[model samples]
Every structure is written in C-alpha cells, then in structure tokens.
Target: METRSLGEHERSTSQSPRVIALANRAGAPAGHVVLSAERISKSFAGVRALQSVDFDLRHGEVHALMGENGAGKSTLMKILAGVHASYEGTIEVDGTQAAFTGVRDAEEAGVAIIHQELNLVPELSVADNIFLGREPLIAGVLLDRRRMVRAAERLLERLGVAIDPESRVAGLRVGEQQLVEIAKALSLRARILIMDEPTSALSASECETLFKIVRQLAIDGVAIIYTSHRIEEVLDLADRVTVLRDGKRVVTAPIGELSHGAIISAMVGRELAASDRGAAVQDGAVVLSVRNLTLDTLGPHGWRRTLHGVSLELKRGEILGIGGLLGSGRTEILESIFGVQRGWRGGSIVVNGETADIRSPVDAYRLGLALVSEDRKERGLHLYESIGDNIALPSIGALSQFGLRAFARERALARGMVRQLAVRCTGIGQQAASLSGGNQQKVVIGKWLATEPRILLLDEPTRGIDVGAKQEIYKLIFDLAAQGLGIIVVTSEMPELLLLSDRILVMCEGRQTGLLRRENATEETVMRFAAPGMAAWPHGTAS
Candidate 1:
C-alpha cells in the first residue's frame, strides 16, 4: 500500500470552497418555488424523529435529500407523504397552506412516494398494479381491464421501458419491478414525487433509464424529492441538495456548488478516512465449496435460470467478496448457501471436506452457519421483540429444555453476547425496535455470534450504518476472520470489496464471470468482470 504525505492531504482539502446556487428556473418569481416546509418537527413515542427541519422544493427541479439512517430523511419524507399526520410544521404548496391526514389525502394533493421496499402485489399483473386503487372504471361498479392495460403500456413506453404490461409482476426482475412502481405513482398524476433509493436494485443500464425518466419529469415541471446513499448518483442527477444530520437540516444547496468531498464532510462532519484497498487475509484452508449450483427463476414453474452452474471456494480466515450489479444473482448465491432458496438443483456443497445437505435453515444452522440477510429488517430481526430476545433467538432452543423455558439462561446468554458484540441498548430487555440503526445492526451481528457459526454470510452488512459503527463492524469481522472463520461478503460498494476481500468473485447475469486473487484484484478488474458488456477481465492497477 502506498502512503501520501500530510502536505498532499492539506493541499487537497484547500482545493475547494463552499457555495450554493439554484438553477434552471421554470416559473414563480424567477425562482421556480413549488413547496416550502417550515420548522417541521416530529416525534414518535416521546423520541424526536425530526427536529425543526426547513426544506424547499421547486418546480422542474430534482432535489436530493441525504443523511445517514435514522438521521431524519425518512421521517421528513413520511411527513410529506402524509404517513405522519401529527407532525408539527407549516407546509405551503404554491403559496397556499396545506395539511394532509393520510396517504390518500397526499395523493389527492398531487403527492406520490416510491418507497425503497416496493409496495406491489406480485400476484397482480403490471397493468392492474399501475391502476391499482384508482382503476379507471367503465361504470361506478364495473372494472375496465382493457383501458388499464392500454394506459400501462403508454406509461412504460413514455419511460422507454420494454416489458409486457399484462405480465405478472412476480416474474419480473427487481429493476423492472421498480419501473412498474414508478408507473403506478405516475398514474396518480403526481406533481410532487418522492423517490427513496430508487436505483438501489437497478443495474447500470436500468439506472440510466431511471435517470432519463427523472430528467423528463423535471422537464415537465414535476417537483421531485430524491434520496440515496450513492453519492455519485446525487452528483449526476440532483439540481439542488438538502442534507440532514441528527434530525436537523444541516445545509441546502445547489449540486454544482458542493464537491464530493464537501458533501461527505457535511454529512459525516469530517472527512472520510482514505479507504485501504488491500486484502484482509492470507491464503488459508478451503472451508466452503460449491459445484454446479443452479436455481430456477420465480414464476409458475418459470425455467429462466437465475444461477447457472456457479462454482466457488471460500477459504478459512478469508473474506471472500462477491461483486455484481444488482439483479445479477450475487444475492442468490448467499441465499442458496444459507438454504433460503429450496428450488436450487444440481449443486453440491462441501464444507471442511464434508458434503453438506442444507435444505433448510435448520440444516444450515446445525452445521454452524450464519446469514446476515440483505434486507436486515425483513430477514434479520423480530422488530417487535426486545433486543435480548432478538440476539438470543437463534439459540433459544438451548434455553428451553424438556418443554420448560429457562429465563435465567436466556438473560445470561444475551448479556454475554451483548458485551462481546459491544451492542448499545438502554437495557438487555429494551425493544430492538427502540435502538438506532447502527445498534440494531450490532444486535443482528450478536445474534449470529451467539451461535458460534463456522461460516458467515454477510449481505451489505455495513450499509446505512454510521461511520463509527461501520469501523466497529469491520474490526469485529477482522477478529472473526483471524479466528479462522470463513466469511463471505456480498457488497455493492466497490471500495469495500477492494479493501476487505482476500479473493474476489465477480458475477454477471447469474454466472461467475471471473475470479481475482488478492495480488491480482483491483477496482478496474472487479468492475470489468461485473459489468455486462466486458468480454474479458482486463489487467490493470486501481484508480
């Protein structure tokens, strides 16, 4: 690894200045003002979720909202969407005071929100979903399916999305499904659109399409509220940016006025530590192996293969990195290994030189396996339960013997793991839902640690956590790897993959496209393998 001098760091710091300016006026006093939120504050069960945040939206502008998880971005957006009716604030829409009592009310007021986790019924067809609650009816009672299909087709055509309007949504890929969600919102005749991490599940090309749609919406005078953790996307797409930190509005400015470094510094209140791009392990024993793994795609026996004879080896004391654009089946690999996908066929899993039959989570758990799933809230924790219960849930069987619950044993185990994992909580009995985003993640890690898994599957483990918490998790991962535990990490962050992996595997369109040893791996090589258009892995140094 190369090192830079303090002089260079100082010089880089002083290369930019702070300023902000609005742009591309559409209407309204030459300012394009559409909506303004003044002194908005909200609390949940006595906990302040947002505190006196002032925000603005303009016609024909894509305004980006940014903050770490639990930093008030979602709370503010929810208020705008009328999910929280009791928030204290004054919202003026086109210089008229407005208030909403429900999501329906917000939609009636020309507001629409597309959440990170899509709200769609897979059993329904794309056309039905687009016209979902407010379907165009022939009469007051009878439905109009043909008109709905035609409308859906037109919507997709406008966005340049190629997909059957009558196709079952369940069979679509994540990216295509996201487009359908947008179409549903557009059907609402929205003047103000709130998009939360819209491109998170999109491939590079899919992202480009979404960007074009956003641009088109802006050109049509739509006021857009865009939020994402991907900084590069904000730089490319946003007209103006508003940042929130610790439930307070830190700054609101035009995109061109803020450099990438300045945005990072403002969001984090400090510079990002220069990421170390190197291996976190040495060559070690091969602990996990797969041969000819395949999964039939989802549908009524849809035979579109999501995984195709994929094979890989993960060594003990190594962080095996899985790299791919979203929807490329990188997540499926982990799910298959953890027994989440039972439709997998023609695969042999060898762990520590022994053939493993992992048909269910029980089978995987008994073999000392742990999985931190991609959607942490959906797959990792029981939100209504206490932190103690969640951390010891996997090992609860041990706490109950002969049909008797061992309360003392459970408490003792939870306490031990909490200390070991450095989990922050008001108390062991505190609700898991009460903890902050970073602490909730720690509890998830603690749950797996209690089982003492020999193999660990981590999917976007550090996403949305604060910088301090991320550093702690990295240290914990390093400690576990040092103890010879086999760790497989699936991450979207290219820098994270470069820094943590001993060996990297790049997947594209359900295929293991290429492999790189520690000495051979670089950002360029991994990206080339992961990108769909690259014919072969290119040899080069990292940028």
Candidate 2:
C-alpha cells in the first residue's frame, strides 16, 4: 500500500539514454518512457479489432489497460507482444522505431508478455519449460541441465516463489504455475512486462503475493503493463490507466483522476444500472429438495469427508445462494445435486415431490435440471465448434428428424437463444473461441437453455467478465427467476451473493452451518457462519 514516486528510480544507472530523452518529453522529473505504440490498427476478415489506438509505458510504472470484452484490449496487447505481425502500427522502444516480426523479436527487444491463457507444457519440468527454446548448451549440442536448474532457481528466488525446478508443471497448482510463468518472463531480462489477467484464477492470498512481486519489479525499474477485469486491483496497483472501447482509445490519465464509476462508464460507454434484488418473488411450491448428502474423497492427508450431511431446498421462482470459502464444499453441493459427484451417498433428491434418480448429468438434464460449471473453458462449451453447434449440442435429438440433424431448425434455435441472451457476435457461424469471455459464458447458458431446463445451477457465473457484462448477466438471471425457474448460485464474491439471493445457505467444512434470509444477511454474519468450527447459533435463527 506504500506509494512510490516515479522519480524514486530515475537515478538508476541501468536506464538507457533514449529512455531519459523520452522522460524529458513528459515535462516532469519522473521515469522515462520505455515503450510506446502509435496509431495501432488491426483487422480480421473485414472486422476492425483495433483502430487508431495509442498507448505508452514508462519506466518503473504500472500502467493498466482496461476495457470490456471485445473492446480491443487483447488485440492491442497482441500487437505489442508481437503475436500479430500484420498490425498497422508504429512501435517505439527506447525512442527508436522497432518492428517485431515474432515473439522472439519482441523478447529480444526487451519486451515480454504473459498471456491470460498460460502457455506452459504440462509434461515438462519447471526448469525445462522455463528455458525450453533457449536452453543452455555445451559444445553447441549437449543440454546443460545443471546450468538450467541453477538459473531457474535464481529466478524463482528473485520472485519469492518456492517450487522445485525439477518438478513437472502438471503437478503444480494454478498460483504456482502463474509464478513460474512470471519467473520465465523475468529470465528474458525483460524491461517491459505485459501481464494479462494474471490474477484471474488466483486465490486472495496468492493475489497478495503476486502484487508484492509486481510492486518490487517496478521498484527495480521494470515497466509493467497490467490488465485485469477487476477494477479494484487497477485502483490499487496501477500508476496510470489507459482505457479502450470499441477498438479505440477512450482516455489515458493518472489513476488519481479516475473513480470507480468513471472507469465503468468509460469501459461500457454508459452508466450500468445497479441490481435490484429487493423486489422479492412470491415463493411457489418446492421445486427441488435434497436431504443428507455426503461425499468421501482421498486427499493428500488420507480418506476424508467432503460433504457432511448437507441439505437444502429450492422454491420455484427463487434465487437461492450458496456461500463458503474455497474448499468449503460449496461446489460439491451443486455437483452432488446434479449427479456429477461419483462418490456421493446417503442423499435423497426430490423433484416436484417425487423421488428423483439422478445418477449422471444426462439424468439430471432429463429431469429439467441444468448446471453451468465454474470452469467454462474446460467443462462448458466446445471452443473449436461454432456457436450454433455448441448451442444445439445439448438438445440434438429435439432438433433432429429421422436420426438426422435438422440444420435449418438447429440454426433457428441457436439464433433465437443468442437473441434471447443478448449475445454479441458476428453470426451463428462464428466459432466459440472467437467470442469474448462474456459471450462465451452466454453461449454456455444458451446451450443449457436449449434443453428447456426448469432448475438452473450456476457456479461463479460472472467470474472473469467485465462490469458491463456482469450487469447483463444479473438481469438475465432475474428474468429467468421471474419466469418460474429455480436458481441455485454458488459464488465467492460477497456482494454478488447478497445482491442475487433471496436466501443464502452458508457452508463450513461441508456442513450447513447457517441459513439467512435476505433481511438478515450481512458480510460479518456470512463470514461468521462460513468460518470453521464456529459456535452454533440460537435455535430458530435460520429461516
């Protein structure tokens, strides 16, 4: 939280003369310009991904590039990282015009980028992956394994990361993998580091550690280009901010000049309406019920219980929330109800007052149940397929005739779902990978809607999306609940849980610790229940 002035690192002897010259142009005694791009424009098959966008980075400063999904932030970063060589732009490094033809070219020019989707080989050792292509060699042929491991150890130590260099990447956790990625970037001696959504999948504790490393890098005269959808992180870490919208630069200013609302307005091009969850829906009949669900799993410590006699109920047209810390079995409850938990036992599920037999996801879907898992990329949509194909995948039989898929009817259904969900895409034929994060999530939801589900199980539905897209999703959820759909949402964000749920179920160590109505839920109350081994509340406190 300490504030360091840009001038604090100006006296470093490592700065190049060109950087000093660029610093003089700023008309202030601060860090010099390390990299700049002017009039960056790119097009893909007649679609303009970026147009006349301008950006610059200064030595020892953390500059944030932010925008809604499909707003050209990634496109611009790709150009800077040399991933797209056909872009129309002029890049200047150290006050000299530079043209990078490939990723290697950018790295050689002292610029490196860590993509949002990590690019590490899971089967390779940490040291081998870090120095894969540029590995040290003896006699111009033999691999220098010792040298590579030693170098990797030094880099990891510099970043305050503790990981065995000989360990395979497949066994590491997400946060450790991220740190390895950073260590790899630093091995290139990069003067400008571009990190895209670095903390998207990281836990709260890991984020703090990463923040410390980022700040330290800046103090060491590294120019950092940071991009994230989390606005609070931008406010906390960025020295300056550049916002892009619709493939054009909207504004560039000091972080002190922007407020939370201003940044949201600029990214979305309008004010986002606050969610109104107070207009309570009159509770209808019990739509789904679960009794005494339990699960056993083998972990590092040995056999352990994941879920301990968990029970919950959902009413028609109601949004029920599940809240808990990570590993508190919030996701397990949904997986148990959806029949995806293979080890679940001693549970009875009743749908509309009849004993239901849901042994698999297909059975759950046939019972008018749908689950939108948290990891969309891995579990939800097929990225390689078209939007229409993904949407029609769940209900192919319904759209088929004589065992042949009805193409015309399938396209019509996909189009209808896209329209209903307000999905932004060029057409139904576009691949799911081409769409942004928000649209990808929408497609996942649309695929389930094709099955005509009555009860929706959404887990972290808004996890890596922008504020504007989150607002749209909230509206969509409310609309669905109004149409008599029972919604069960499991979220880690406290505000989202409070804003969306009429009643919340708090879990602690896989047990139903507390249930609070909307009128009584607060951050403190929810945390108290979510804490492990908390004392029992008074009888009748839970609604």
Winner by lDDT: 2
**lDDT (10s digit) by residue, model 2, range 103-215:** 99999988999998899999999998899899999998999999999999998988888899999999998889999999899888888899999998887778999998887
Candidate 2 steric clashes = 0
lDDT for model 2: 0.88
Worst 10-residue lDDT window for candidate 1 reads 17-26
**Model 1, backbone clash pairs (residues 3+ apart or across chains), number:** 0
> How well does each candidate superpose onto the true structure, as a TM-score?
0.84, 0.93
lDDT of 1 at 182: 85
Evaluate model 1: give its TM-score: 0.84
Worst 10 residues of 2 by lDDT: 21-30
